[model samples]
Target: MKTFTSGWAFQKPDQNYFKKFIRLNNIAIDGIVYPKKILADIEGIPVLGFDDAHDIIQPDDLVLDVSTNPDLRKELEPFFAAKDIDCVSVPDYLDRLLSADQHDALLLPVAGIKASDIRKLKSAPIPDRFDAHFLDAESYEVASKLDGIFRHSQWQRLVEFDRDDPTGNVLFNVLLDLHARGLLKHLSA
Candidate 1:
């Protein structure tokens, strides 16, 4: 029932046969591909998977959105009312799930450093391979913008500071490096 609508659905496509079925032989299923139509049936409920966007839907599939898609809402409401399937708005769902503690859990906290430790922290060279792999200009921009505590929105804004780099992996790796170096602490509740 919990579906991510903001392209934040944590998923990796199964690199297997039926996935290939979509790629290789769409004609076999009347041109209905995995993402183009309902990808599969999950316990009698059709599951539609989308990342950037979806232009299609079947009556039986579960779809997630942000309530911003009025056209889709109008189209999908009959199915939802009949309990034939579910249509969920992720932002609304997130509002229901998020509390102050839940909100705080998502922040990355910068560790407090003493003046004495500043030199050590600076002198401690980042490993060359790690630097080469993760520390690009984008990553540096992200890292430099981290505060004592910050949320994903702040981090996202920092990532998009200079240019529009929507690829989150580089920013993730940069944060991961800070975590590895004991400079960043992720709070959980």
Candidate 2:
């Protein structure tokens, strides 16, 4: 599952701040996966709070400078509550962002490849050096994989053929380059 929190750096409580925060908030709310827990430290407890601001924090807890807008905060509460996303004050959100780990779900409205997929590219030939590297062993391996899959399938779908293989990254990257160069026909989503 993906995770996300709303964060907006505000100089003052103004129309611009509200507009920007709403745009950012929509991204979190409309996401395929919302954060299940909001990071917070309340009353010496490392608390995970949900949409209810009162449940997450006490008045004694210091409110963030960025979250001073009661009007915006109040407006956002219901939207967050409807989506069941944990809401924290901006200060807590900032802290959570800084300390966020791989397991920590951030808002992911769209799908993206994992870091492992990108790392796979290193084992593939640098595509532009085609003449020098084409005859090399690694380049030959990449070419074989590319020849196997070409424009016959989507890169993501094609990668499933031994998707974990390093050569798969080369094939995928080459496909992207080909699509970029207008050599391959791109299927519209």
Candidate 2 lDDT, tens digit per residue, 1-189?
A: 222233222233232422343354452321111123343432222333344443544333333223334765565556455545555544243334324524434332124532232234434544553566577766666665654332221132232344455665777888888888878876321
Candidate 2 lDDT for residue 37: 35
In angstroms, the error of model 2 at 77 is: 0.3
The true-versus-predicted C-alpha distance at residue 177 of model 1, in Å, is: 41
Instruction: Please provide, for model 1 over 49-143, each residue's C-alpha lDDT reduced to its tens digit, 9 standing for 90 to 100.
Output: 44212434444443444233465556445534444445454333323323332323322212342222332333554434345545576565555
Residue pairs of candidate 2 with colliding backbone atoms: 3-105, 3-106, 3-107, 4-106, 4-107
lDDT values for all models: 0.36, 0.40
Superposed model 1: Cα runs more than 4 Å off: 1-46, 49-63, 67-69, 84-88, 100-103, 107-189
- On the 0 to 100 scale, the lDDT of residue 113 in model 1 is 28
Query: Where does candidate 1 clash, by residue pair?
Result: none
Which ranges of candidate 2 are over 4 A from the true structure? 1-9, 13-66, 97-189
